[model samples]
Target: MLLCFMGSIDRFRETVPLAELEREGRVQTSVDGRALALFHHEGEIRVVDNRCPHMGFPLSEGSVEDGVLTCHWHHARFELSCGDTFDPWADDVQTFPVEIRDGSVYVDPHPEPDEPPAEHWMRRLEDGLEQNLRLVVAKSAIGLADAGVSSDAVVERGVRFGSRYRESGWGPGLTILAAMRNVLPDLADDDRKRALYQGLVHVAGDCADAPPRFDQEPFDTEDVSFERLKAWFRENIKVRDADGAERVLRTAIANGADDAHLAEMLVAAATDHRYLNTGHTLDFVNKACEVLDHVGWDHGDAVLPSLIEGMATATRAEERSSWRQPVDLAAMVSETFADLDSLVESGAGTEWSPPASFTETLLSDDPEIVVAALEDAIREGASVEALAREVAFAAGTRVAQFATVNEFSDWNTVHHTFTYANAVHQLARRTGARELYRGVFDAAINVYLDRFLNTPPAPLPRPASSTETDLSVHLDELLDSFDVEGEVDEAGRRAAHYLDCGGDVSLLRERLAESLLREDAGFHTYQALEAGFTQAELRDSPEEVRTLLVAVARYLSAHFPTRREREQTFTIAARLHRGEKIHEEGQ
Candidate 1:
């Protein structure tokens, strides 16, 4: 009788006879259903997992020399006494305790684990991130998942890492992670890992070439007035004094300014320059806040100050010729700012609900009318947050209705407006600052300018157009629609059909995520999906949700069928994760 002990107790199971093992030089046996190879190395029996760590090739076929075991498949060498690999990529093989007694060889199939799951994977994650090894990163994600760690945990790790390591502050990688996190709930369990893996890989790429960020010291004073700190922060940002701004911001936090207070200061400064860097500064601030929302504001020391570089040094829209062109849009926005305070006071505490056609009016061809309508809303007692939500939705319509016939780059023109408005809306909701109404107006103007990209707006998927009831079928059709070019409208219709027929929202979200992840998706592609889900939540009517979803589908479809090189890289990662022999020729 033979048995292997597991679960903290050591029990031995029989393998081949010791004489037979020495004669053959190696023996293959299974104990507790785990295949192990016993080798006669240096006149002693050594046992190891039969499968190679590199590619699962049988270790019995490997040769031993000078007490070193080498996997024949990849020629990876390991010290026989332990499982440590000589080659880093090969990874360490798993070894078992072996004993020879009564002319027979036995193994303790279960021994102490090498390391806790978290410890090993976290180390591998750092290795993966530091080395920019996509395969290693993928394996870390898989390993962590197997250990029952939440996807959020992985994402937060990436956030902290990307935020800390990159001297450039927040950029596409963090934004991409934030966007992916925004839609994380919409993804299936497996896809969630894929999404996080994608996020981590991008962060690695972003920080690989970038300099590391060093923390700036806060002002010595621990007790400063909020008004004074706010004023100082805004002033430093205005003059592009990043060091001074970081000091001001850090000092504010040092003085115990709450999250809302910090948001208030950032909001005022972000709008001070009239859409800083095509509204990216505000969006960056918003994303910083957003990421903090996930990872906790206690990370403010690391997270919030990073916004300093972007905000202080960002180019203002007003500085651009486009904002001052034939329309003199810059002058027009300033004029609105002039009247903003008085207008907001007139509607103080009176919540003026926008008309049903409010979004349509915001889409007016005339920037003048768009701003005027916003002023009217403010005078009608519309709160800054409410107006911002309306403006953001209107911006979403620009992307939802974007025409593919235009120069492809135009998608970003509309995309910047949508994400900017979304950011403004999020901040307004948080700070409830009447000052942020400036962003609302700026967004509406952008919407007005972006009108032609939708000159012949892609027709919204006809309402309830499909009678199809099977949810799975809808998801299949929706995903299949992206295989070829020119499936934009088809994708939109399928998404509409899925949502309109009371199909599971989660299912729709899952399919949308799957479709997006499969392609060589761009930054804006991620924005479209996340923004759609976010904007959808803000609307009361189911129809509004449908509109946003269709917009999401249309945008993704319009950009579908990319080279998908990323997917191939992910495939290799997945194969390695399963410990499959990826090296065998045609096997």
Candidate 2:
């Protein structure tokens, strides 16, 4: 036994006798509430925090060989002396000063202030983003967020890093940030934190492996007018010349072009090719604007350039008329465009709500009637808000009516129509830009054109009378029987039953959303399901709500087929390892 004495403050305190630790290779002791592992390696004493930084596993149980300490759980290795981890996922652990005092081991518990907590964590965030280390990224995000760092700072940093590191420019990660940005406002407090973390993760991962980007020099003109810049931007985007477009945008920004002008230019380019890229290019551009709002306009230099790249690289769905069969969509859409101005002017001061028949008019296979009815409603004094809501619902119906037989990629077809319409609806409500209404008109035209693509057409349940079934129980049954054939019809009927019984549509919607979230559905499912709910929320009519819910039920039931159940192989292996009968007692 060793008699140890406490030293002055800031001095190392004897933790354990070296002779006691000689029997084992290491010893775990606490000094001032800090746990540390003291190791006897090659006659030299080394000390480090006992907790593995990876998952808080006690490092005292870890193996030390060849100057490396290895965690038994995940095989994370660290240099015993420096405490640097070889695994990026497991962050470097803190090492303490070791002192030998009278055959006893002493450890200094106080950590040296190598850097400020905020700065150190900020650097870790960069490393996590660069390496695509999920746990490290999450920890850094949470730590930074808890330290009162704004997500704006994190986003600005990510935008700078991503733009500089990826030579090819914005990729899916940028798009992902753009995509997730819209959901932040709708998320709860905790979920908002998660959303921020996810957005940063994508931006970081996108730039991780790529080389630095060399931005094109701004056109050497000091006085490029907003109009001329706008003209050039539209032209370059139209021709799919990303370099030309980026220069025009950058030059415009440098010459004092306001974000409003930049927005108009992007919108002009987006609408130039009606429903471009099934509306995703436009949606992405809109999301980019949202990113600007979160991160501040200073990042526009890098962020907007990526948007230009998206515009240049997008595959415009409007260019292809292959899906316009059974109807002359080109002619129908053109006629509707001619009447848009007169319709808006006439409907400017009118007080009207969309008739119950608007859904039927929308669902009708005739593009001409649909367009004409929409214009008539607007001319008859239907508010832009009402019109927006109507068209938005029709777009959701297109998604809901889409059949799964259209192949995996075909989901985009309806998704484009729905998202495009939803974006226009949202923009109209926000800015009341008449041009955005035209987007709605274009979406409607496309929706009408896509009516036939629903091949087996969505099965809308036509229950004779709404039954008195508990909506919650019905939803549960719908989920339970999702794998069985004809379940889509049952789902529709259940939806109808709930609507008839005067159920809380929002509750039912929440259930549906929860089911999708739990099932690990794809992106398109989320887009479609969410669009339908948004449309439903905008409407004032119960009948319209019923129709929307039925469509949602049908869409989800059709797309989300039964996942085959399987036993866990690890469980089977464990059973076999226990000495249980191998191979079912026979065979």
Candidate 3:
């Protein structure tokens, strides 16, 4: 029996056990420092190279089923006995001779022959890439043709160029062809004709390592056929063939064309279809509106109301069974409203208001209809306040049921926070509601403080020079809202404990300054310092305030500053009493 060992078999035996191969059905072992796959198949022990021929996946770790080993990566299979390729699409792995002698399995220590040339492998890769591209283009073209485009012009154009370009290897040619097909109905006839010619002539010249630009820009388009096609489409077909042309184009577009390009095609089809068939203009408009709605056109006020009125009239004219009537009407109205909202957001058409007629319809006696209308409005970015008021009024008049404030809040959070915040701020400023603003400021401060106190100290906001004064003012307002006495008591306890624990006074002073800087100071300079001091030992407070107050006192003593300034005088006195003295007046 010959032992086929490639690398250090000792290292392989150390990582995996021999018994694991028998019990587990397969075991990956490295022998002679090379990976080896060991498994029992058909009542006989077998071993083979661990690496796959394709992509170098470890075969030993793969599954063994019915004498075949399957590579876990990419599902390439190999025959364990001969190391022959089992998967027709993939290459084969190397086989090694193994035998069991004296109750122990032995492997031959010899490497397999060298792999094929890089050029040979590259040719295969290029072929595979081209084949995949052809499949994709063919499939897409067939789908487009099936969508009622009677003229096979688009597909023929694709095939002609696709075949000619495939010789150079189909990568660049397939991409251009796919792009053309996606935008065929949308592009002007001249552009489509040019694109077809470009695909054919694009990759000419340079058999050996050609520049990519040759593949990108086709030879200067002076070909008479290309020029003739362009001229015919421009002068003759565009004007005369508008109706017949648009029908084919729209069919191509509806049959899985490109999204951004198909929008223009649908629009053109709608316009031409309406003009050509006046009796069916309303039907064409409805279909076009459906497509526009799908594309999320926010039909600002002008287009949406008209579309909704049209849909309403259609619904009334159509009398169908219970099942179809409600579903169709609901779908039409919903789609129209959605398109209207999209149009509004897109800034399309003129700014539109909800028409009185439609608003009355929304407030109709039928609860189901009203509910459906409200849902559509909500889906389209209608304000929460507007929706809620409508619901409330509707419910009061037995038109519809109302929703709760929590529901409105939830809805607003998802859709209307930007509008709501701006509106609230505007109201506060216009009404001069300082108290209301103060309440909001306090709430914001509490939220920030709660987050900071619970979470780790985050990196502080980079201090801004101009904004520092504004921050100080806000800090003061926040401080005024706090219970100073209660905060001071807590600070006193903390200070007493720190002193008892032998903490340095300088460290305490630094901590107090940091706390002051970190505190949410809401639009009031003095209150910011007050809030900081209320939470710190008075003796540990910063000297800037003391210096400022001392200057204020000297000015007051020099000239009696007003009663408004008396508060500043008293504050300075208290600081001085607390052993925080200023060195110089106004210095």
Order the numbered candidates by lDDT, best leading: 1, 2, 3
Q: What is the clash tally of candidate 2? A: 0
Supply the global lDDT for candidate 1.
0.83
RMSD of each: 2.8, 6.8, 28.2
Q: For each candidate, what TM-score against the reference? A: 0.92, 0.78, 0.22
CA-RMSD of model 3: 28.2
Candidates sorted by TM-score, best first: 1, 2, 3
lDDT of 2: 0.69
lDDT of 3 by residue, 1-587 (tens): 23335653421122234455567767777666566777877786777777664545567668878888888877888877777765534555666666554455666546445543333333332332334322222222222233333223443333333323332222333333332333334334333333322222222211123322112221233333422332332232235443333333333333333333333232222222111121122222322233233323332111221221122222221233321343444344334434544533543333333345543444343434554454455445444333333322211111011111223222112111111122222223223221222212211111221221212321112222332233333223223323242232233334333333344544443333323222221112212222222222222323222222221111112221123332232233333323343333462
Q: How far is candidate 1 from the true structure (C-alpha RMSD, Å)?
A: 2.8
Better of 2 and 3 by lDDT: 2
lDDT (tens digit, per residue) of candidate 2 on 139-192: 676667667787777767766776677776665566555444544444544444
Off by over 4 Å in 2: 1-14, 29-35, 42-44, 55-58, 72-74, 99-103, 108-118, 151-172, 185-213, 220-222, 323-328, 335-353, 377-386, 401-410, 453-521, 525-587
Q: Cα lDDT for residue 347, model 3?
A: 36
- The most accurate candidate by TM-score is 1
**Candidate 1 lDDT tens digits, 1-587:** 53335554448877788889889988888888787988887777889998876667888888989888988877989988898888766667889997777999978888888899877888888878876777678778878987888767787788888888888788778888878877777888778778887778888888897788988788898667899999998898888888888888888888888899999999998888888888878887887788778777887877788777888778888888878887899899898899888997898777788899998899888887788888888899988888888888888888878888989889889989988999999898899976798888788888888999989987787767446566677778888888878788889888888887778776787788898887778777887788788888777787878888888888888899899877766676677667565666795
